[model samples]
Target: MLTYFRQRYPTRIEIDEDGNTVEVPLSDPMLEAKLHIALSTDGRHWFPLNANEPVWDQWMRDPYVRRGPDGVWRILTTGTTDGYNRDASGPGCFFASSKDLIHWNDERTLPLMEEVRDASGNFLANNIWAPEWFYDEENEEYILIWSSSFKDAGWKESRLWYSKTKDWKNFTPAKVFFEPPYSVIDGTLLKHENAYYLFHKEEEFGAKTGERRAIRLATSKKLEGPYQIVDGDLNDGQIVPVITEGPTIIEDPENSGWLLYYDYCMTNRYGASFSKDFLNWEILDDVHFPADARHGCVSKISSEEARTLINEYNISSSTDK
Candidate 1:
């Protein structure tokens, strides 16, 4: 914890609102501990919602945002106390809930990997990464999912696991959610029409030649899925040569289409593509993201909510703050 005060981590605001993906560069972590808020009516250009105000103080990875049934805005992210990425030896997942994204107070932690064990009493996974949850409207529960690797298996064997929760206080024991033939991480889900679309980063060697870390798609009819990967070109002919990870899916509120946001980590760039139907994609250009932004989720809020957030967090009206 002392390291936090001594060293500031690189953080960025990466969000997908409506159809456009916007990434904002935060000046410093200590100043924006709660996290700076920004809003985009057009989605392409973003305006700051708060001026150097902290939205959240805790460290998070692959942070996901969603509104809960109780009308609280909840963020479920991979929680870590030490080390970079998801290698820390603390809570497997961290959760925080807020009526406004600015004043988050409700908090909870789950030692999922430590608690859930195999028949041999060995922990199934230790390095938990990218935890996310969405409301299962039909079932009336929130289905939480994340990626983790088993102790017996190596990190390359990382796969997704899920649990159910209602009040965000207690959760059902973790269970395997999706297991592709190869190692995978950074799993995200978006429901369209009646089917659920899952986007994940898979580790595999390209069929013809070299090592490949690519974004792949899978689909299922039910929320608790036996998701099948959509077979085709992994990058859809875009982002060739450079690999990508951390795929986020969101509905295009403006066009009714969908947007896929991913990370080009090697280049430290955020990428996006649009699709009316999930099958076809047109890689989008002109999308700008903060250099430090890595894996984070986006969500849409009402205009009133946005204004309230700005006022509440004291985001300066003038851009130059």
Candidate 2:
């Protein structure tokens, strides 16, 4: 199942002072900033459920869905109370659980950043976004990672923060998970063999420094760690191009390699890269996604599960052949 957020922009046409009509984009209070689920036989083409309406009607974005060890599906999203008033600062993200993909419950804010503090007991996080779940089979615990900016840094720089939790109800104090010299966000983890590969976005766009807004990689021997940046001939350490974010990696269904999908925000299109090893990647062509699909994660679903969601949402005709 492919889970994403559908962004809606309502516009109104008005006569300007120069007597010419112009279409002005208006803000949506809801922002249509809710979770939408879709089904795809192949990862390229997607058919939206609920007639392209949001499956979960909540003001959240960047939905990451994963089934826990208990066989229950859980989703974590960037949470905000008022969609219009949202900024680069927030208290925490939101969480929801589901037995089946059709019905979700236990929706509430995680309040993760409330526990993040500096040595002087000062809470420095101004914004929290893109919380991802990684189950550490070695440690038998779950790690929740997200990005945050600091009050001390004037919220200009961001880094990945993480916490350990055995149960979803309780979490250890948040600590810096990965902090490079530059700002980073939207981290997704892939564990291969004994190493963990973190694919994330470098948020810097300094023209003089030639820093492009693109996705880069870092790997570590441990889950929470001193991750070293993988820099070499792999596009000079950047796998994807500029203006790409919200990366979700999944294994190729054909068992040939791995597929990494990211949101090309500037072009409103989804881009993909193919990789066998974590170090090298090839940008793929001929990938297609649902119109207006924004930042979200992709998970493989069984044939029965796909049929269940399609029947429940009554979107049989929407599926692409």
Candidate 3:
């Protein structure tokens, strides 16, 4: 079974001055964009796991779910608290673990940015975004990678940073993971045949820069890298649309190649591309996803586990395909 964990934006209906009913977005959409679940037998059709309600309702975004070697599922999300520094910047990302995917526990902040500092020994990051976990088989540890923007640059130049941990409780000091010439964020890794591919969003725009806000690729031999960008048609080697972000890739369930999916933010929909070599890609036009799903990762789950979640959440077959 295929499982998708994502952020959902809900709305409320209200009457206007003309007595017309209008769908109004939540008062604080970002805070309300909580974690939701969807399940699929095939990659093409999806069913909401909890009647379209958020499975983990909290102020979080960009939920990445991965099951560890210990048989526990863990989630790292873009979250924050009011107790940290009393500013707009998030002290760190949010974390939670579960033996089963339905009920989560041990929810807390990782405080990752606290360990990141400048030459003056002061914390430099103003925000932490899109934390993802990659397990290194050779090193026998998990590497947590995320994007951060420095205070010195007024949070303009976002780059990827990472830390290593065997247990989630303690992490190695945060350090620069990837610092390209241009601003980048939403970094996700794919390991194939002893090579590591990095898919990230180039967060630059405008006529002067001649850059686009789209997904780009970089590759390295080691998990942590001196990565070289793959040259392509778009500026800085982009592979997708001009207004896309939040890229996530999965092995095709019914095919040999891989499916790379991303959020078309400007159009409020999802798009996909397919690749077998990871060097050449074909944008797919007929793919489908659950309505309004945003910025999530896909993982395979056991059929028994999927059934349990479906029963617990009362997911109906009538949901959108």
Q: Per-residue lDDT of 1-321 in model 2, one digit per residue for the tens?
A: 789886544553344556454567656522467888877766766778887777766778888999988888999887774211122333678889998986889987787877666697656676778889999988889999998887333114788999889889999988899999878989999898888889998876533435456788899998887899988354456888777888998888755789888887655567788888866788878666666677779898788888888777756344331
- Superposed model 3: Cα runs more than 4 Å off: 1-31, 81-90, 118-121, 151-155, 234-236, 316-321
lDDT of 3 by residue, 1-321 (tens): 323334333554444556444576754243235777777765666677676667766767778888888899988887753212314333688889999887889998887878666687666777778889998989889999998887433125889999999988989988899998888889999998989999998886544564367899999998989899887665547887686888888898878999888887555577788888787788887666666667868888998988888888867564563
What is the alpha-carbon lDDT of model 1 when measured against the actual structure? 0.63
Off by more than 4 A, model 2: 8-31, 81-90, 118-122, 151-155, 232-235, 316-321
Residue range 123-217, candidate 1, lDDT tens digits:
55666777888789898888888888753322357888888887676778888899987777878888878999888887644333245577778
How many residue pairs clash in each candidate at the backbone level? 7, 1, 0
List the lowest-lDDT window of 10 residues for candidate 2.
81-90
- Regions of candidate 1 where Cα sits further than 4 Å from its true position: 1-36, 48-54, 81-91, 151-155, 205-209, 234-242, 312-321
Alpha-carbon local distance difference test for all models: 0.63, 0.76, 0.76
- Candidates' RMSD to native: 8.4, 6.2, 6.8
Q: Estimated TM-score per prediction?
A: 0.78, 0.85, 0.85
Candidate that beats the other on lDDT, 1 or 3, i.e. the better one: 3
**Ranking of models by lDDT:** 2, 3, 1
